[model samples]
Target: MKRTPFGAWPCSIARAVDLLGDWWTPLVLREAVFGVRRFEEFQRHLGIGRNVLAQRLNRLVDEGLMDRVPYQDRPLRHEYVLTDKGRDFFPVLAAIIAWGDTWLSDDEGAPVVLRHRTCGHETRAVVACAECGDPLRIEDMEALAGPGLRTAGTAGTARTAGTAEGEPTAAAADSP
Candidate 1:
């Protein structure tokens, strides 16, 4: 079946999900963040099929989240390195890890713990308001219309009406 593209959606979340929502992409990114640079290494770490690994790497490169750098001249082998945009995605991965460790871990506890090298302390990721430096909780947050928002009959609105249930309403999905 053909996949419905979400890249052009007005919602930043939707666009991000479009790029990274697949099961393998985030794992590949996690490996990259953990210093897995080579194709063989990613495959071995992920236990993913070679073809799928290649596809995910290519997609990440195309999306500007990763840079494919030539490492070997003889056979032209390349290494995948995270770009600035990809590095910026680290917090998202941290949040995912935090959630998993909290909700899904066994009684033995989280298999991994993130420690800060500079502070020499273990840390957990938390979302905070940029302006106030206060932790942001879902109940404390409110959505407001932004500059890129569009109403019905407005020009440059890319989304169509009648999206499936559980999807963001058009008015709530403002372009970024």
Candidate 2:
């Protein structure tokens, strides 16, 4: 569960994958975000085993992406709701939907459309800079080492920029 270093090649992808990469995890989050709060509801919608659904929900709560609320007094039934961090994943889910609509849709149009309540218009997910309102592309961003950086020599040759084979760049100190 340890996080790999930033600025490392594929580090962002790896961290994201580590956090919510599994086949069931995103679906669980999808259900939670979409208001499928009850355990039975998730089980029915996903057709996942009760035990697997239980584990995914527990993991989300442990990770602080979800809050468990009491739904029934007797025997304490509960429903899971998204935390702020979980809500922040809306863009990620939208992107996933976009990707599916592009590559997996049977028809040219999307299977399910997301409409803005205020505008009454269907919208697509966009990645944009908050300050500039500029759309972000892969090449528009740069990843820098954060508070986790360590000296390249001491950390590993994985950080040597000119390392002969299978080495990480100098900018990527903690990449292994």
Candidate 3:
């Protein structure tokens, strides 16, 4: 089935979703973040078919998330290394992991524990107010319009998570 392209959407989230494509892309990225660089390694870890893995890697490379570097001089083999943009995606992944650990963990609890290299302590990701460093809570916030808000198209008032189009965004000055 043909998929709608969201890269042109005014919302950054939509554009990111379009670029990430599907489960394979993020899984591939997860591996890349964990230092899995080569094609064969990604395949082994993900259990994704060769063609599909190739496709996802190529898309990531095309999207500037990963760089294909020549790793072997003899066979011209390459490894997929995360670019700066890709490395920057860690927070987003960390947020996802945090959410999963909170709501989706089974009887054994979270499968992974993230540790800070500098502090040498295990920690979970936290989404907080960047300006004041307060943890974000839905009740403590309000939605506000943004410059990209499709103008009369919308600067919607919904402070809800991306449940619908035109969800709210908070500005530094925004107060509930």
Candidate 4:
């Protein structure tokens, strides 16, 4: 069966998953953040097949997360570098690391520890509210209809005909 296209979803998380949901994609990004730039380095670090690694690298470049930069003159060698968007993915990786260390680590403890550069203290990633700067808990948040949510009859079904720009439509407001 054909899979649903997550890019078409109105949710931001769904769209992000559409782009970065694949297993190898995140691994590749992890290596990139750790300073693995050359094809051989990524292949060696990941132990992934050459064709799959090449495909993932190409996809990352095509998706604007990485840029291929020429490093050698004679053989036309290139290295992958993270773009601004790719750099922005570090927090996501940090959060994953924090979760893994907390729940998956052995009794000896986490394999790696992150230290803050300025204060020289260990740090862990946490999800916090942008406005209040308070750490967020899953149980404390509620999902609410946003303005970008697609309203009925606009593309799929017949319902309310008009919704003001930036206003949640009646159909969306009524949806659980």
What are the per-model numbers of colliding residue pairs?
0, 0, 0, 1
Better of 2 and 4 by lDDT: 4
Model 2 stretches with alpha carbons more than 4 Å out: 1-12, 150-176
Q: How do the predictions measure up, each by TM-score?
A: 0.84, 0.75, 0.84, 0.81
Model 1 spans > 4 angstroms off: 151-176
For model 4, residues 15-36, the per-residue Cα lDDT tens digits are: 8898888899999999999899
Q: What 10-residue stretch in candidate 1 is worst by lDDT?
A: 152-161
134-155, model 2: which lDDT tens digit per residue?
A: 9876534544454333434224
lDDT comparing candidate 1 with the true structure = 0.87
What lDDT is reached at residue 6 by model 4? 91
TM-score pick, better of 2 and 3: 3
lDDT for residue 150 in candidate 2, whole number 0-100: 41
For candidate 1, list the clashing residue pairs, or say none.
Answer: none
- After TM-score superposition, the amount by which residue 134's alpha carbon in candidate 2 deviates from its true location, in angstroms, is 1.2
Rank all candidate structures by their TM-score, best first, as comma-separated numbers: 1, 3, 4, 2
- For model 2 the local lDDT of residue 135 reads 86
Q: Compare candidates 2 and 4 on TM-score and give the better one.
A: 4
lDDT of 1 at 49: 99
Once superposed on the true structure, which residue ranges of model 4 sit more than 4 Å away at CA?
1-3, 150-176
